[model samples]
Target: MLIPFLIMLREGIEAALIVGIIASYLVQSGRRHLIPAIWIGVLLAAALSLFAGAALQWLSAEFPQKQQEFFEGVVGLVAVAMLTSMVFWMKKSARTLKRRLQDSVEHAVHDHPGSGQGWALIGMVFLAVAREGLESIFFLLAIFQQSRDWAAPLGALAGILVSILIGYGLYSGGVRLDLRRFFRLTGMFILLVAAGLLAGVLRKFHEAGVWNHLQQVVFDLNDTLPMDSPLGTVLSGLFGYQAAPVLGEVIAYVLFLTISLACFLRASTPDTSAGAPTGTAMPAVTSPAASSPASNA
Candidate 1:
């Protein structure tokens, strides 16, 4: 549940931030007429996300046990791929995202600066919302395989809605946020989630007879962290906590977390300069009714 919630929170925040950035840019630049298109795009994307999530859940339950494992394994791998790319993409593009977004908007508007503003605006909103929405669906599906419960999805939805409120507050000048810190903290959690996904993928593979070796039983911790216990269930929801992890799962989780965290932590540092590319940035932000500020980070 924690994993789903956090992932959805982060994902929703990104989408909201993108929309906010675009909206703020337009308002600041006296392009308020473009607002309607953005709204349309945002709503459409949200609907699409809901549809996709429901569809995936419904479709997956139709599979046989073996097929379910296969499907789970495939989705797990894809989720890891998407999750890692998202983190690194943010690290690489966080700095330049604003500039790129700005430039793209400008180019679109200029190329067709008349009624075409609607199209350009819609494009911006669609891409921004859809990107996050699609990612969330994939991540949530991967998470569902582990917990096989409805709470995960409910938690994710709640997380995303809460994130919208947070993004709204930040965008409306209610609070100043250090996105770097936010991502760093969440990134740590994401790493843990990814590690669990990694172990899950391995489990699925083994169940499907993909990798047959390294199946020795590791010391069982079910006695200590019984899955039925509240703490255990919470941990399992968030970090894919295992009561009796097999040797491979244990090794995979540790190795992936150690290596991924090392690289992720090194890359997780926020850009202090807005001039930097996606992963590298000067961390400059435009505050509402105030001068642009550069974070010390």
Candidate 2:
């Protein structure tokens, strides 16, 4: 339950932040007429995400047991990849995102130069929101398959609702937040979740009989603390806790978390030695007001 809630919360906040940035830009630039188009794009993206998730669930239900395991394994692998890439991408882009988005909007307006402007902005917001929405759906699907608890979906719904409220607050209520620190902490938590998913993918692959060479049990903690217990279930759902993990699963989990964290930390560190080029002023889009407080909402 907690797992899905956090996942959905992060994803929802990301989508909301994108929309907020675009909307704020439009208002500041006197292009408020295109606001409706932005909302339309958001609605369409949300609808498409819901449709895609339902379709995948329906399709998975039709598969046989063996095929289902294989499908789950594939989906888990995909989710890990997507989650990892998202974390790293957010870390790298957080600082420059405001400027880049503003520039893109400006380019779109200039390129279209007429009635087509609305369509261009609509397409931009649609693609941006849809990307995050689809990513969230995939992660949720993978999580639901593993947890198989009613609470998971409920948690996800709650997270999304909260994120929407927060987004609204950031946009209209002028809420102040330290977005840089928020992304950093969430990114770290997501990396741990992705590592667990990677281990689960390995387990699913073994269950599907695709890999049987390293099936030896690494350790057994089930005797001391059964995974089906109330607390154990929460841990398993939130962090992919395994009581009797196979050797390969343990290795994969450790290696993924260790290496990924190292790379993430290194990438997030600033290069202080490099000085800015002379005769170049920071763009207005990079200004504090222009960037808006909702960039990370």
Error of 1 at 246 (Å): 1.7
| Alpha-carbon TM-score of each model against the true structure | 0.88, 0.91
RMSD of each: 3.2, 3.7
> How does candidate 2 fare on TM-score?
0.91
Superposed model 2: Cα runs more than 4 Å off? 274-297
Worst 10 residues of 1 by lDDT: 276-285
Q: Find the candidate with the highest lDDT and give its number.
A: 2
The residue pairs that clash in candidate 2, if any, are none
Q: lDDT of each prediction vs. the true structure?
A: 0.78, 0.80
Model 1, CA-based lDDT = 0.78
> Mind giving the per-residue lDDT tens digits that candidate 1 earns over 1-297?
667788989988778777777777787788888889989999888889889878877877898887878878888888887787788777677767778888877887788878888887797788788988888888888877676668887888899889888777766766566787677778777878888888989999888777777888888887777988999877777788888889999999999889988998877654556454444322444545654542323
